[model samples]
Target: MKPTDTQRLLRRMFDAAIAAAQPALCVPPLLPPAPKGRLVVIGAGKASAAMARAVEQHWPGPLSGLVVTRYGYAVPCERIEIVEAAHPVPDAAGEKAAARLLQTVQGLGADDLVLCLISGGGSALLPLPLPGLTLADLQALNQALLASGASITEMNCVRRHLSAIQGGRLAAACHPARVLNLLLSDVPGDDPIDIASGPTVPDPTTCADALAILRRYRIRVPPTALAWLESGDGESLKPGDLRLPLIDTHFIATPQRALEAAAAVARQAGLHAHILGDAIEGEARDVAKALAGIALQTVRRGQPFQSPCVLLSGGETTVTLKGQGRGGRNVEFLLALAVALRGEPGIHALAGDTDGVDGQEEIAGALIGPDTLDRAWALGLNPRERLDANDGHGFFEALGDAVITGPTLTNVNDFRAIVIDGPPTEAP
Candidate 1:
């Protein structure tokens, strides 16, 4: 295929993947029956506001509540209040919104219904620190964890224990109300507890587990926080907790579903699509290297599958931030993939976050092809040095290869595709 065709094809697959996970498409069908009593909606994440809007559009009964999403992600919702907050880190707005969410579910009867919309980035958007632990403490802890390369599960375990409303605490607060949780899965494995720290569900992890993760990462906590953990006072509500109300959870969107949607797009273009996995996770560079090896093998021998195929995968990856440059794990993965490919013929790749933001930047991710390294060399850019500095954003942006999709209003983790072609036929 031509270079422009390759880029366009890859982007089409990405758009399809994101469309499959949109709240409007995923939420309405799964909404529960209208309750006899009040229906209160509460949520937190990059997708929660949109999910709340979906609820408002579908529900037949009167429903009113609140949801907090990352800034620039809010959609129009009439009954349910949509609040914007900082994501990947907690802020004052998120703290206030979280407190209000807990109160919104209070004083409810068993007949009342609580619709909890949860998704990726919810952990940071619902930062109601446990008693004696301040929001600043959560902020510093989140910063450390982001840089520590801790898995999403580990980071959320700590978040669940340290927060007043995470884990099953929010559900417990709605003692007599029935909670119908609609979750958008962005973490690997689609574990409910890891999605927004499982605010409306029970936590299977313990305070001891959170403490161990903190120590494993060498992350120090406030003295008060430490004392609280040691005292077991910050322990999250666990399974079989009697205080929790009647709760039903559903995953409206997941990585596997998104990958399948992307795969369908590739197949429609007469390319064989293979879904490698949906829950792959590791260091960004490490994952890139491994995937590059597979792509090279497919190109050279076609052992796994024939050429003219697209290998697609989805999952969140970590980047241990060591450089002072702009860092996003998706960009980091793409840059590493480019270096590993070393301008191999008939190979093109794209890696991006479905949420339309990679790391702290608005850019989604980037694209790479056989001429990627040569193009960099033409501009006197050292790809290796940029990779070493975790400056994937800078490197790709300079090449004008950065993919920008503003506020996709959804999160199903990362999407990666490697396209390989068959060798050209000799002139007949």
Candidate 2:
């Protein structure tokens, strides 16, 4: 029942990835110079509260603000108020906090600064729907999008249009004041505007583009929402908008950084690190199958990489919810990889969301050892059935392999590592 060396290495890599994105570590060194006037901070996302605390610790000028984080991800701050809200689904609490954030920035002088801490899940954490769209409408649409398997960019594009505060609208609220948006990117490509729907940055995606995405995904929208989009009433702040010129943005942390940190861990452990890509994206199961194939090749033929190497990948993956089991993209990908690998020797893998929560669950993801499939079968759990049912969480939970690092107060989407050792040597 002792843990293997590969398992230990996998957990270490995950921890390194999470540590690389922590707000305290990544946000402080990049803090902007204080403004002449009061610095008013505001933000929304899983990391916003932590990011706010980082700003308060480093900032010298007088400051006050509010930030919204997903419930249970909050950190204490003296000057900045932290509000917890639902994520991946907006709640009334998020709406209220978002409103307060906007109000806190009003009437600032040209010399004043608005510090906006933004990260993943902000689109749901700052749901200030435009006129005529009820919270209920947004809630329903968000549920659809979560189930629709839409890419993060597509989902945020739609969100930017529907929100009153997102998509550079928050920057517009600051008007004459200088706006500094410190963003921790969780989306592929690290697009600042897509992080938390870009509340303090210009939105390049149009309402027309939003409409196109919705139609492509066949996500049902209320007639009011449809009409609003068609009329451009929900349009976000565009690139040419005058208010955006004063706004500045910095990507304080990103998925690529996280992956690189993990890669460093692998090299320290004497394993050659092969980073496939930092922005890999696709259906979770499909991506899992592809990675498994590559891992097999490395083990069987030593083609892409030699033995004793670890493959690292980071980025967000999607899951099209159809079955009735608890699901998360990370677990889904891990489970599918387990199925594809089928107890393949000398290969162990781990996948988890860097935020410490995956697919609306507190569980980050799960680990897959070479014996993963055999042990699951012995425990009466069918990996194939679980994957088919989209029960990735359930499947891994039954095996007690779920990685449960709750509320790391950061978000970088997915972190995956596959270690391939040489063929098992004969045992005495």
RMSD to the native, candidate 2? 2.2
My TM-score estimates for the predictions, one after another, are 0.98, 0.97
Report the CA-based lDDT of candidate 2 relative to the real structure: 0.89
Task: Report, for every candidate in turn, its global Cα lDDT versus the true structure.
Answer: 0.92, 0.89
Q: Model 1 scores what on Cα lDDT?
A: 0.92
> How well is each residue in 1-428 modelled by candidate 1, as lDDT tens digits?
23489899999999999999999999999988788999899998999988998888888778899999999999998999999999887899999999999888889998999888998999999899988889999999999999999999899998988899998999999989899899999999999999999999999898899999999999999999898788999898878889988889999999999999999999999999999999989999999999999888888877577879999999889999999889999999999999999988999999999999999899999999999999999999999999999999999999999999999999999999999976433221
Worst 10 residues of 1 by lDDT: 419-428
Q: Best lDDT goes to which candidate?
A: 1
Stretches of candidate 1 off by over 4 Å are 1-3, 424-428
> What is the per-residue lDDT of model 2 for residues 9-54, given as tens digits with 9 covering 90 to 100?
9999999999999999999998877778888888888998899988
Per-residue error for 66 in candidate 2, Å, reads: 1.0
Error of 1 at 166 (Å): 0.5
